[model samples]
Target: MTVTTPSIAVADPVFPGRWVGGASLVLGPLLLLTGVLLRLPFDFFFPAQLNAHQHHPDLMTVSYSFASAGWVLLWPGVVLLAARIGERFRELALWGGALTVLGLFARTFHAGVDHLAFQLVAVRGAESATRTVSETYGAFHVFSTLNAAIMGGWLLLAIGAYRSRILGPVRAVGLALASAMPLGVLKGTTPLSVVAAAGLCLALVPLGVAAVRSGPNPRAAAVAGRLLLLIAAGTAMFLFGQAG
Candidate 1:
């Protein structure tokens, strides 16, 4: 007679296992799209963006918040995409993923600047804020070096995807449009931004759905356990956010 034991899986920190990666893939771009759409009515420039934020603080905050959050959450999904691409084209995936992640970090860095600029509008007036930003424009920063990666990485990643056959050519092209997304502080949406977000939806959302479906079965016990863990994690973050 033999006894067999069932396995309980723990997720790695970086990869975060399949379900989270899949959710990130799906949710990140969608949230970004929502943000882009929300800002479409505004002019697409740093100065205009500053004025818009000052006049419509709440809406702009929500817009930028959603967009920033979406981009901030994208690294996990990129990791998953890179992992899949690496199975076939190791070099492409390696370079592409590294650059893409760096670019994502650049955006996170920009979000901090964007927040500062937004605050300046309330304190110093929109013109003063814009003047401040213009004065500091092109100031030296480590992230400045990675600026090209903003567009460059997506293009390479798209090529890698096509070469790996992980994504069809059309979807690959669409994925590449993410390269067109605007960068820098207090940036506003353009047609390219809309296209980029929509393209990402077309490119990644399907893969995300597929990933979730193929991932570990969410049995009742596993689901309950995960829910409790999620609640605990959220609570911890909230509490810590308020702590000394």
Candidate 2:
């Protein structure tokens, strides 16, 4: 008589599946979309004189400023997603997320302050259009610089994830761009606006691929589904801001 051995059953992986359903997956796309939209009427990332090509001040304020606000909500999702993977660089991801959000908040206030400054200069009648252009443009550069620094932190986390294999080869490239964006800030003379916009656009690629590869994370997906409604709400807010 032969003795038969019992077979062992193995459990399937969990977190990778968790990827799709998470809030980060949902908000990441929305953030990308809103950022892209903000870039459309003009390159909002960069500060330039409001020429005829640009929207009126109010509309520009609504589109450009609020888009930054939307990113504030959107970025945390991505950070959290990174953390969920249990990577060693989770803290870096968290810090990067915090920095990005803080930067956006600062930039939003900067936009408001600059708008007021513009109005004051206009009232003075001594305000040369050239002067207004230079001042306004400079302020945007300051905010863009801050944003670039935050991106540097994010890049560090992305590289960490890639080295650990949490993020795939192609996906790592996108994160690399996200990380490098801050270098533009350091240069001072560099065109940070162009770099930031390009970086943000590149960021979408990794996020999108990760969302696909991780499959549907039920929790993340639910968060994403809810976020879609939030985006609708955001759209309403944008419209109201425009109308108001």
Candidate 3:
């Protein structure tokens, strides 16, 4: 008689919150890249001439629209990242997520006023209208408050991630450093700013890949497909608009 040995069972890896986290990872860089492409061609510190504005209204519009859309991905990414760090860091995650969401919402208002309203006014050659719109929308940014919340929130989230060891040291540090990107933008476009943006994009890649590799779930897969399609459609529209 021969004796048989029992086999050990290996459990499948399931990342509880990877659904939103994964989507955010996949979409976040797409949003960032689109925004950078839109901005890099222009002088962030100076106003465009009316003639220039008229000639490239579609480009401006597409860039602004896509950039604004980026936030839709970004806010969720922030929250899901916090969630991935688990319950031990719950307090930090909660505060960070709330503040980040608030800051992102404020930023959307800024984008609306600047890209949609201001662009319209600029195209029409109304200097007064542009100024009024700028000032009115500017009130919401209150740089100090908005910037602080965004930066602080990310910092806290990064710290939580580091402590939880979910993203490990390198990725956690990268995320923390990315939080400073807003400050770079505030200083106007420079070589350093471009470098910072590129670095942030690189840092986000691993997070996105991890989310994708966390194995497939029906709901997450569907959401990911929709986001991919949305990006593709938006890109196509922008290209078509530019060509026309």
Candidate 4:
């Protein structure tokens, strides 16, 4: 009689990238919604003129801060989505992600300038200072460029997602539609733009949920879920701040 040898099980290769994607999915939209809601009182519009930004310094400052935070979350999500779609489309994803990140970086500058310079002008009623800041920054033109990069990047990402089958056709289409939200900036704030922004926020939820369900790392997903809960709590606090 021969003794049988025991078999050892091998684990699947862990993709640490999934964790980044999952986190991005959870945080990006939530942060964006928070940013938008924070500015609701100011009737803020993307790519708004310097004068408009100056008109609502408090709202602008808060909104930009949250929006900048959202973009920071979104950049990683973009890169992870590209990786998830696999090797064939990886280059496209990289290009798009890079452009989007750059755009978001530019937007951060815009927000900082608006928050600080514009707020100062608003508070002190300094027309000369306002002109100096506006001229120095060329704020609206920068915003226009920022919008183009973000929209173009998202459009490419949506196409890649559809092609990769990572996201289903419906969800991919939703992403494409969401990317159009940037176009609203050209029209300034309107009822339609508000609806579009809401739609974009809703569209992001499915992607995040899918990322959570498909995550290879259970521990990472759990951690992301906990973080999302914290975000929800923070959002509630933000709402309370607004109400107060």
Clashing pairs in 1: none
The candidate 3 region of ten consecutive residues with least summed lDDT is: 4-13
Which 10-residue span in candidate 2 carries the lowest summed lDDT? 4-13
Preferred candidate (lDDT higher): 2 or 3? 3
Tell me how far the alpha carbon of residue 35 in candidate 3 is from the true structure, in angstroms, after superposition.
1.2
The 0-to-1 C-alpha lDDT of every candidate, in the order given, reads: 0.85, 0.47, 0.59, 0.58
Q: Of 1 and 4, which scores higher on lDDT? A: 1
| Model 1 segments more than 4 A misplaced | 1-14
Error of 2 at 9 (Å): 23
Task: TM-score for candidate 1, please give it.
Answer: 0.90
Compared with the true structure, what per-residue lDDT tens digits does model 4 show for residues 169-242? Answer: 55565566645554422123444435545554554555655555553556778879989998999999999999
Top model number, TM-score: 1
lDDT per residue as tens, model 2, 52-113: 11335565455444444544544544544445433455566566555655554554555465
Number of the candidate with higher TM-score, 1 or 2: 1
lDDT accuracy of residue 29 in candidate 2: 44
Steric clashes per prediction: 0, 9, 0, 0
lDDT of 1 by residue, 134-207 (tens): 99988998998998998898898899888777787888898999998988878899998999999999888887
Task: Pick the lDDT winner.
Answer: 1
TM-score of predicted structure 2? 0.51
lDDT of 3 at 198: 58
Identify the superior model by TM-score, candidate 2 or candidate 4. Answer: 4
Write model 3 residue lDDT over 1-244, tens digit each, in one string.
Answer: 5332111111222432565566676676677656656656666542452223455767766665666676556775666666655456778888877877776776675565555554565556546544554565345445446767766776777787677666556656666765665441212244544554455455555665666565645687887998899899999999999999
